[model samples]
Target: MPLPNGYSINAASSDESEDAERLIETVSVPPQCCSARLNLAVLMFFGFSVVYGLRVNLSVAMVAMVNNTDPKPWENHSVVPAACPRSSGAENTSDTFQQPDGVPQYPWDSETQGWLLGAFFFGYLCTQIPGGYLSGHYGGKLFLGLGVLGTAALTVLTPLAARMGSYWLFALRALEGFGEGVTYPAMMAMWARWAPPLERSRLMTLSGSGGNFGAFLALPLTGYICQALGWPAVFYLFGGAGCLWAVFWFSLVSDDPRTHPRISKEEKDYIINAIGPQGTGHGWSVPVLSMLLSVPLWAIIVTQMCANWSYYTLLTSLPSYMNNILHFDLQSNGFLSALPYLGAWLVSTLSGVVADKLIEKKVLSVTNVRKLFTLIGQILPAVFLVLVSYSGCSHILTVTFLTLSTTIGGTSASGVFINQIDIAPRYAGFLLGITNTFGTIPGIVAPIATGYFTEDNTLAGWRKVFWVSAGIGVCGAIVFTIFGSGELQPWAVTEEERAETDKRRSGSISQ
Candidate 1:
């Protein structure tokens, strides 16, 4: 009754070679010095960091990207005339890139800026489902790496695109979005294969936090780059870094432990056994109708949409908000704009550890844990968002509230984001893709809507935008708390999978 490679399993009478090979993969910690899974998490963390780095650099650069000499096009559409003072030379710096007096300027307004920010999501929206399917069926290694590489290549072309015209710049940004759209779903598929249930929150959030980290770095870094090397250098530097990352990504990582060359045998055995049956195969259908009708799935979709509404709004608009409302200069605006995401990254990192411990110790049911954290992520941000609106010109108070909102919302990393895996580990990729499709809608809509409201860049208009965000947050929290769940559905298993289960059970009994 010796196990394969000295591996032991609680279940007896398993003679299948695949089972033997797999059981060898899952276990308690091996005698190895380090876990390969940890390495994968680290790579994935930095991978997502690179994705957001390329994505958000434009937002920071936008402050210095265009001329403010003429009245913004949306000024006529204003709720009230924008009384905010434009940045003077002392704050803006006499960088040749800004070249406000001497250089040619694009004829864009707040509305046009919103369109540019939102255009990425238009192309981003098109590829989610296909990306999920491709990553799951084919392996995420190629999809994830190529996706980042494509985005990096496009990013370097952004300055040239901007020089062409507004429409051209928009098109280029959309193309970049198309490349990046695959990232989350591919990462989800890969994590489905790698993450143990107990360790799920920790690993997934560690990777997810990279997005916040990217935002954290990009705002300040891009601002400084724009100040020194000019706006184009921001694109060149981040894009080049992304290209280098792609080279390292291809060399360093694989989709799963089974394929990773450097992983230890004991660690491989531990992963396979701990992960249980991965009910995936070629020609698998995604159970589309069931997913559409599922309450928990819809809850995730709605909540994510709400979250992204606030997140994308802030990501795209925060610099302008600071610049206009509180009168922070470009460098100060970038520094202040990045602060909230730093809080977000910190919260996400801490909450991941706390969530895993709660589930591991059985202090809360998985369903309840998701609901609790989702509520925290939702309601706290709603409250703080409203507080931010009212705080008005009080710089310290406004920043603190914005930071709290982002930090609390970061709990969703462990909550709704990882809940898909709890309920549908086999199909987590597709599930995330579906939810993210809804989630990305906010990315498309929020900036545009905020722009329309804040066209005059007046405090009254900005207040309206925050109010709308808070309302959506409340509705999402309510719906998700009532309908969300973490239990696997029966339909998650195919007929073949059920038969395999029965056969394994019968074999164990007959022994």
Candidate 2:
């Protein structure tokens, strides 16, 4: 099927009506090797898994690293703390923080711990734009592989750094963050050379969901590793795994389809044909002024910042909320915190397939599909998040609402999350760098915002946090619905090609 915008996919025409239709032929090659693009997706998946694993392991590992005999700030505030009555099976579940048997635990207070936890974002912010540009100019494979490898090397030194001083560990984590910051944007650069338009959703989702799955695995498993071995082993094992994965990535993946040693010519031809001349670079400088002024670009940016505010708020604060209000113990909190991501991982993977199917069948135009899923991902989650706020101290209701919020949010994998590629395939990485830099604001600010709102740790304060998240999510969805486009932006092309690339159906793909 040929799209007016010049994208062609091996899909059947929409209707069997009066119009003569042709079946787009499929590429049939000798079974000499599995699909290289598919292999790239898998490698990208594990790379993302390692990315998130290293990122979140510290959340769990630090608990064992700290000697927290002091009562929690909320508990110590009132003469008789107002807390939910302990549920059945929650007795003696008051989080008893034991210093890991053999390892030395730090005497750092909560303020110090907070800084340590946030140190990663400091360095993470440094590399976004540079990473995206450099990866595009050069190859993403080097930066992506080196970034992970560097982070792994730093992770191995975490235990040593912690033993030296609080400042040492903080600096080390910041370095690790700087190293890993290239990952998201670099991967986008890689995909620009590889992912076909129809396959974009599934390919991106397959990799993106790895972060969710990584969190699902890391959260609970980190605790288990710490308990069974020692706190140091948590860093050692995950870091080692990252190093091993980097070796495989470097060995197996390449930057461009044209240069891939093992890729089949027939498959490569199909990719080239589907993507056309635009798949390769257009040999023009990026249209910075046009990108700055573009409405759709701003729409996507606003939506990302707002959406990420909601996402990061829950990611960083959910454990504390459960522990404080819902009355789950640390161990239970870890498992429960991980559960939402499990649902998210499953939904993200499935929604991707559904999205591709919808576009292929012409059930909805690509723009509508993006809008529909963004609405589902962003707006619908607001309702459930509100339900979570009102659910009060009910553990079952809160968990259910939160899970519903997260699972529904997974549709973004098909929606605005991947819209960067739709709008600007050539600049997808740079665009992601811009948006994610804004998105990272939430990662830094949300935790701090949640802290400010819930300083008293009252049910009302916690309710405010969820309400704000829901409100931000709603606002983002509204902006995206109004201005977002799946049709490529005019700025994405060279000035010469811009006029010839007449506006595609802004809402639909059909004639």
Candidate 3:
């Protein structure tokens, strides 16, 4: 094929010829519409929403799944009042046969409940690195589509597994987690292909907000579904919705613009110019050992772990707290629990916009911007989390604190979450996999710990949980502020690549 005016194809072998062809094809593409990538971002947004929806439905449904009888001996098990006074037939229900409003409860204790909740993360942690590697090498489209599809399939089978008993249910949930674990890495790979440096915060945050949105919707929706139909319906409904979404995802999405049939040439060119070159020359390999030893990467891993500790604590245990401590009924519990994620979604979206604006205006360097928001997200949440511990039984005050904590933490979507991309776009997927594996540990540990500590289900027990979460968040913020970086690491490129980049810069300067 003919090449650009000054550029010539000099290939010594078939492999070199193939590489040269790809490079020319990337640069020679026609102009494409900007909306092509925007549409990709929108699809990613909804994809994450489905992921969290399937993941979190169990949290709300579990409130009704297990027997939530008071741990205290003095409480009259026979005279169980409705979760709230507004419950229908609260007064008319017979004390002998029915407890309060007649919601079904199981005989499972808090510790068993905790283990069930954490099972998903066990399978989740297993697939991170493999998923990232597959996405980077093969393509993100198939893996991302299959991950959600498999989760949906498992979700639809949850009620049956639960009926088979706790072990069966645990195994099922673990498989579901395994499926969902691939999602973040797959999506990070997609972003590595699609997101331009200046627009990374906004695009990544937009997709990430779907998690908050899913949580916001899933809590209330699961509550109402469990109330009207049964807890099983919550599983059936969300699982079916996830399946439906997978169809669209597989049909509509491509791994990158070059592979997308419908993408305009202009948009393709724009993406290529903005994201820089793709592929490494022969002999270039990811410095996995070096990355493992890097201080900044470890800082990100620590902060992610701490952040998820708070996130998972709230995600898994909030509904229980609302029911036990605050005395919210199933419906009320769902609504109240979902409120903070609503604030988080809104704040996350806004933070992305603000982060992009600040960087575009050159008011702050990328590293400082990441550090600034990381501190805000971590510190403010720590403060509010402690306040939540002291809110007593004042429902309004407690809810306010929880909402404020998540709202502030939402800023991390624009902070450390996107910082990995800034430091190394080529390995963004792998780095996300490494950090998220650590992050999932809190998901596994925090719930079990909370269940152990809050077996009494008292304000005091819950306070201990919040205190631990707050302390972890505070420590992470301090370490990240000192060691975290947004600048691209030298190890990301080899000596040959560095020389080529320097040559390009010198050529541009002379022109």
Predicted model with the maximum lDDT: 1
- Pairs in clash, predicted candidate 2: none
Model 2: ten consecutive residues of lowest lDDT: 16-25
Error of 1 at 331 (Å): 0.7
Backbone-clash count (model 3): 9
TM-score of each: 0.89, 0.87, 0.87
What TM-score would you give candidate 3 relative to the actual structure?
A: 0.87
Q: Give the Cα error of residue 433 in candidate 1, in Å.
A: 1.2
User: lDDT (0-100) at residue 65 of candidate 1?
Assistant: 82
How far is 326's C-alpha from truth in model 2 (Å)?
3.5
RMSD to the true structure for each prediction, in A, is 5.1, 5.0, 6.6
Q: What TM-score does structure 2 among the candidates reach?
A: 0.87
Per-model lDDT = 0.79, 0.76, 0.78
Model 1 lDDT per residue over 1-511, tens place: 1134332221222243333333334335664236888888788888888898898888878877866523443355444444444445455432223533433456578899999989999989888888888887776788889999999999999889999999999999999988888889888888878876667888899888999999999998988887777788889999998999999899989887888899988878667766655523324667788878888888899888988898899998998787666666677788889998998898998888898777666677667778888899989999999999898677789889998998889998888878887777777887777888889999999989988998877888999999999999888889889999866656565454466557666776999
Give the candidate number with the greatest TM-score: 1
- Residue 40 CA error for candidate 1 (Å)? 1.0
